[model samples]
Target: MLSLLGLLCLLHGIWAAPGDLHSLCYDFTVIFKPVIQQWSCEVQGKVDEKSFLYYNCDIKEVKPSGLLGKEIQRTNTWEEQNEMLMDVIDVFKQQLPEVEPKNYTIRGPLTLQGRMSCQCEANGLSNGSWRFSFNGQIFLLFDSKKRKWTVVHSGARLMEKTWVNDRDVTEFFRKISVGDCRRWLENFLVHWDKMLETTGPPTVVPNAFHAKATTIGPRLWTLLVILTISVLLGT
Candidate 1:
């Protein structure tokens, strides 16, 4: 019985999905504050002095209504990806907080304003040399040399590859840039790039999530066994 209880405890602990929102708030809200505000846009949920914190944030839009504008443009360091993803998602939830959060889609070779992208407009808007316009999209790029995940505009390009290595990074881009439209993206990447050290890439697990499930097999059997022992001993 004791052995069974120990095993149950271990399994239960292992099965449980641990969370540290406070830690998240500390790392993202404090350390990566600028990153989120820089990449993403904000949609205020009734702004006031009291609700200032909850007013606007970098997050995936709640729906068609919350769409701010679109992922206009950007670039990022090849090394600093994990920090980018965690920070971006934290901001996304600030606006679209949900129980079972479903991550948005990511595509590659995505030509912004090109006929390829699902949300691409007929007349693609173009920056100096980056993407055009894509709203409510998320892009993810993996650098084999750097071993990091980078988030950027939906149709961003590097190495002259149209969509070969690049994936859609709309929301990830949105989570960082909010109000300052004139922010120099290349300068930002240069500043953040200094912190990059050689590190393995982060693994992305899709669909499969760690959720709580009731483990009653042992509990139920234990009760029966205990009852049986009592009855047998009494008899």
Candidate 2:
């Protein structure tokens, strides 16, 4: 009886603990290629619920021998992280023109330092389903009502949602394969450049690399997992 009680307690504690991530770090450098002029921007950020969230944006060689950069630091709760990232991006958008207005240069091989958290339950949309695609190479169809996470590429399935832990979800992410992701990256940049050139560039081009979109690569995708519940038990 004592053993049974202890086992139950252990199971509850595990479920109550925070999912893998305490902080998330993203760092990448992009070199936009153009004939007349070129642009290179490096964005780095560290975000967490308890610690200070920091973002550094660096624009190098906007003009011959010119450099521009900005840094932001703030602390926020886990629930606030999604909004925090948007605010940082907005700040970068506002600052890009100061560096240089005319140039098209972008390259990837972006990086993520820690686990990325996604919450399916937060949407409050009962039984909603969404298609998750990465550069059109990898796809996941998540059925919130059914609590099903499917791997479109491999035809693998996580049959039970509550029983699914970080390790189980992470394995599904790996099945998409890193090679496919690299191909996606190359294909995406080609189309992206064409759109930019034709559409006359966006209002602000900071050479931004979105962590969620870029997660097709092994380095980034490996860190992806949905934290089903908030951190109820402190580690």
Candidate 3:
């Protein structure tokens, strides 16, 4: 089984950048079992390598994490940003089942991980991308410039086809990644320096796992089995 800690390590490796590159990234993980009717989700936001905000599905609220988060909450656009994130969660919840593999029987829960990032270089260049993973293995990537979906794992081919053909869904992803994400990053950058001055060194905890090894929920064990089936069947 791929532990939550391992999954976070994978994400950090993908988002790691040079000193001059700044990024605003959101990491979302959702786990659910239709059988038991139990589900949970977590959304985390980071600027560069520092985590600033977190949302818990259990509470349906966004909470500021540190000094940077407090400052961000004070901004006039914070409310709007919060609402946008909530909407994103709602969309994901609605869409995930639409792409689920047909005639595939799973013994346990399902895990879906999604990441959206907007990157800015010191030279005024900017770009954005979205990635989705089923059970910890990345299966889909979005190219903002080309407006296309790249399927990494064949199991996700259906997902890519469905999303690419749905103009509304594709445009929604584009607008958030290319437009709103960039604007939010720029706004956050305005307060970046001052906030850093008052805070400690940047600590990147993509999700709740920060230690070498930690206990995770039972549902996480389903990841490896599902991943294996996904790879073999190309669902």
Every candidate's CA RMSD: 21.6, 21.1, 16.5
Ranking by lDDT: 3, 2, 1
Residue-level lDDT tens digits of model 2 in 1-235: 2222222223222322223222223332333333434443443433222222333345322111101011121112222433434443443333223222123133332221112222211112112233432222333455434555666644222222222455554343332122222222223222322323333322432234422333243332222211211222222
Q: Go through the candidates in order and give each one's C-alpha lDDT.
A: 0.26, 0.29, 0.71
What are the runs in model 1 whose C-alpha is more than 4 Å off?
Answer: 1-40, 43-134, 142-154, 158-235
Counting clashing residue pairs in each candidate, in order, gives: 22, 7, 0
Candidate 1 local lDDT, residue 166: 34
Q: Residues 57-161, candidate 3: write the lDDT tens digits.
A: 998889988877888888876888888787777777776777776655885777778899988764446778999988778989998767978899888977887
Candidate 2 vs 3: which has more TM-score: 3
Error of 1 at 131 (Å): 16
The positional error of residue 229 in candidate 3, measured at the CA in angstroms, is 54
Which numbered prediction scores highest in lDDT against the true structure?
Answer: 3
Q: What local lDDT does model 2 show for residue 178?
A: 23
